[model samples]
Target: MSQFWSELVHNLDPYVPGEQPKVNNLIKLNTNENPYPPADSVLEAIRNATDDKLKLYPDPNADLLKQRIADYFSVQRNQVFVGNGSDEVLAHAFQALLKKDKPLLFPDITYSFYPVYCGLYGIDFQTIPLDEDFAINVNDYGDQGGAIIFPNPNAPTGRLLTLKEIEKLLINNQDKVVVVDEAYIDFGGQSAISLVNQYHNLLVIQTLSKSRSLAGLRVGYAIGHADLIDGLERVKNSFNSYPMDRLAIYGAVASFDNEEAFQQSCRAIINTRETLTDKLQSLGFKVIPSTANFVFASHPDFSAEQIAQKLREKAIIVRYFNKPRINEFLRITIGNNDENAALCTALSEIITS
Candidate 1:
């Protein structure tokens, strides 16, 4: 630790993102990215955005992009907030909405970013553990806290809580904000943004990276009551005036315009996820029912670490968390058909031999 570093930095346990390997021809299923490409319209729009206009600074408020998102979600302009990515949007929320005198509350096994955000902002937080089935129990969240946030179809586990359960949490805690990270809602679950109009305390954040296949562009947005959006905007303006660039804004707008194409891509991934789950189960792995673009599975005969190493030897990569209660499970993203076939083939040989 350097003497120049602040005490906060010394105590922080930074979030380690999934590795992005540089090897060629490797079947990468570690990160939950869409196997499909972005819509043609989105590509055309992005290409068009790469013009002399880029020399000019983008709209600091990102008004046009916000309007497009508002139109798509049927929310008002003031009710929508855009950021560099959902991660940044979530970071802003942790500081603006979750830093209270009381501790923030979230699932123990939820997004690793949540805890990292808490550490970054010096927010006191408490974790609510998921049930034995690896599903979120809404009833367990009846405690005093500053705010609450969790992925709907939670990460790694891919188990989802119903929209009614989310609304129940909002209803029970009317005074506090509840942020739902819907990055994977397009896969197998419904979005909680539908309830944002009814619940003033609800904030639903989504990313174009996963579902819309624009991870490289880095665009994400949040929908909520106008007041909550205003609070986030206040924090955002204080930090950076132009988090969304011109290309990102135009690309995000085009993504919303081609909603049908993106929906089709999501459907295909869901189908692949079903097939992948069945294949893993046939190989004696207990696969969780996934609503996200990935599957979480644990083998009866082999440990998660062993399987990950074997897959790596075959030029395939999947995520393995060396943590408790889930140390035996691997979070494998659903790749394209050929990629999935290769992964299954590699696993079959490893298991058989």
Candidate 2:
């Protein structure tokens, strides 16, 4: 809208993030954030890091945090790349690996940011539609795109694809880069990070924001072949050398130190997600089988927009996308016990009324 804007800027369509309300009292389930708090050790580490060292710059390479992540994933330190968040890590991937002579390929119903990143980077792309059940069928990927990227338990839909299916995709498209965006893999689905070493072209991206309960800390990373990591590093260094700050680095390192707390939180969310799905099904909502922290469901008797609005009135918020093929569906994040109970109560009231 500005005269000073470049042609690329003028044509860009930005991604819309989930709303963060001004008030704190509302039950916020719109964004798929972890309901549990970060591990105690993570908080303690972050607090301990706030010292006179704040005056100096954080390590530009973030070697210690990279080493911790590498060790956790059973990969070499050279194969791990850390960034401000998975979003940033993904941005680097789109720029470094995905843009090519052929068009990029992704699921039609995927993280909306994929298309946005394509637009930002001027990368040509095509979308492979999910099946009637909102599940990805890897057979449809073919060998056409320059690269491939899709979420394991895909965003908003929460439908998961198995590692076998993923391996098949990798085999079919051996020549192209395949980026598995595992932003929600910890909820129930297995991570593709396990296969990164087997497939040199495979790049797995993950965020601490969801399962690790570090959305505020803003840490994410990628695991891949050392060459791919080096390519991402080239893009990252050209853009911003110091993506991870001191606190984020130390806190993320501590997150790995406490596996028990991390597993406990993931299990709790998975349990809540199943309970919420069953409750929605009983209330006449056609709930998709979700392996992520959120459930995607639609009530045949009511509009998704109406349900979202009514829940908003009750101080509860869930995501409702008015896009094609999924306009009637609502993506509801799994909250804590009390929050889930309140959400069920509100939905029950809405259904009965």
Candidate 3:
């Protein structure tokens, strides 16, 4: 809206993140953040990193963290690329790999950020619609000489595509780069990182924010062919050499160190997600089969907006996208035992009344 703004800035429509409530008492499930805290090791490492080292710059390459991620995923250190978050990693990908001669392809109802990134980079793109069940049918994506990207257990919808389906997509589009954003992969779905070694054009992006419970720490990475990683590195270095800070590097490294705590938390969230789905269905909400840390459901008798408003009144918040095809659905994050119970109690009251 400013006269000084460039044409690109003037035409840009920014992504709106989930609301972070001002008060702490509210049960916040709007953003699909993990309900568990970061592993004790992660916190201890971050605290230990706070020293005179704060005066110096962090490793611009983030070699240690990259090696940790690479080892954990069974990929080489050269194939791993770390960034501020998966969002930043994705931004680099869109710029380096996705912007091609043909329009990039993605799901119409997938992550809203994809389109925003395209707009920022001036990348031409096309959106393929999900099927009637809100699931991605890879057959819809024909080999068109353009790049492809989508979430595994797709955002807001929480519908997961199996590994076989993903491999099929990779085979069909062998010539084009395929990016699978696995931000929620650990909750239930298998990571495509397992196949990155097989597919030269495959790039798998993940975040510690969800399953690793490091949303505040802001660490995300991508695993792919060393050549692709080098391309992303070129874009990253050209933009910002120091994307990962000292504390974030140490903390992210520690996150990979404690596999037990990480798996335990993911299991807890999966259990809660199932329980919540059953409860919602019993209350007349048609719940989607979700493999992520959240559930997407719609009530037959109540409106999504009305449910969201009522829940807010009860100090509970869930994500409601007022967009096409999914306006009636609410994306509810799986909370811990007490929080889940409280959410159910609030919903029961609201629906019964």
Candidate 4:
């Protein structure tokens, strides 16, 4: 904390993303990334894009990918905004819309990044408690000020709030922005993108990381009214004209193109998640009902840290949060069939022994 740094940097508490361990064959299940590989068409598109075209700059606006997302979501191109990843899209969003006269509102337990974003942007914010069962209560937001943002099927917990409940909040707070971070929407939750046309203040953020199996490519987008999209575009242009490189643009467009493959992958994850939930419950775990590609659960007989540590010793890894409200839970990403089998076997030994 010496030297002359920007006051913003000095005052920031950055978001720490889940670990991407370098160890191979560890049965990684911490990050909610898709366990399957991306569609072959996405690979081919990236390969085809890596050409003499490298000498030329990508469309500063990433027009092709924008058009693809626009068409897929039945929105005009002007109503869509793309970025290197949803995190960046969210950064642009915080700068563009969330800053307000009153403190922003979010769930006390949410995508840990929300508070970090607020700190980074110097935006005042407040947290509302999740219900006793950890579900979002839209009625509690009636006295709120400023904007609101939260993951649809909230991270770590994997519990989803219905679109109807989201609409209630939007209707109640019609004057302020409501940013629904739908990063996991494709897994099972209904998208608020469908309601964007009805609510001008709604901005639905999504990423290709989970459903498209393109976390490596880092492409994310937002769907909203033209005015809301334009605000993000202005902030993005001011920050980085080329948030997406050539390969990312091509690959993201291809991911949207292969809609069938994307749907198949998401369905597979959902199926595996259901089976895993049963296995965890049989092992005496209380698993949260998850609509995302992960499950949050814990055994009544064991500590969350112990479960995570035991799994690590077995060369399996999942996430364990030591924070409040849900400190006893473990967030396990739904892996492939074989990986899930390995996890189940590992948990059987770990829990019993």
TM-score of each predicted structure versus truth: 0.98, 0.99, 0.99, 0.98
Q: Can you rank all candidates by lDDT, best first?
A: 2, 3, 1, 4
- Give the clash total for candidate 1: 0
Query: Model 2, 30-80: lDDT tens per residue?
Result: 999898999889999999998999898999999999999999989999999
| lDDT accuracy of residue 82 in candidate 1 | 97
Q: Write the per-residue lDDT of candidate 3 for residues 1-353, one digit (tens) a residue.
A: 89998999988989999998788898999999888899888899999999999999899999999989888888899999999999999999999999999999999899999999999999999999999999999999986649999998998788899999999999999999999999999988988999988999999999999999999988899999999999999999999989899999999999899999998999999999888988999999999899899999999899999999999999999999999999999999999989999999999999999
Candidate 1's residue-wise lDDT over 11-50, tens digit each?
A: 9999999999887888889999899999889999989999
What is the RMSD of candidate 2? 0.7
Shift in Å, residue 266, candidate 4:
0.9
- Stretches > 4 Å off in candidate 4: none
Comparing 1 and 2 on TM-score, the stronger one: 2
For candidate 2, what is the total of clashing residue pairs? 0
lDDT (0 to 1) per candidate: 0.92, 0.95, 0.93, 0.91
Better of 3 and 4 by lDDT: 3
- Model 2: per-residue Cα lDDT at residue 110: 88
- Clash pairs, model 2 backbone: none
The CA lDDT at 8 in model 3 is 99
Number of the top lDDT candidate: 2
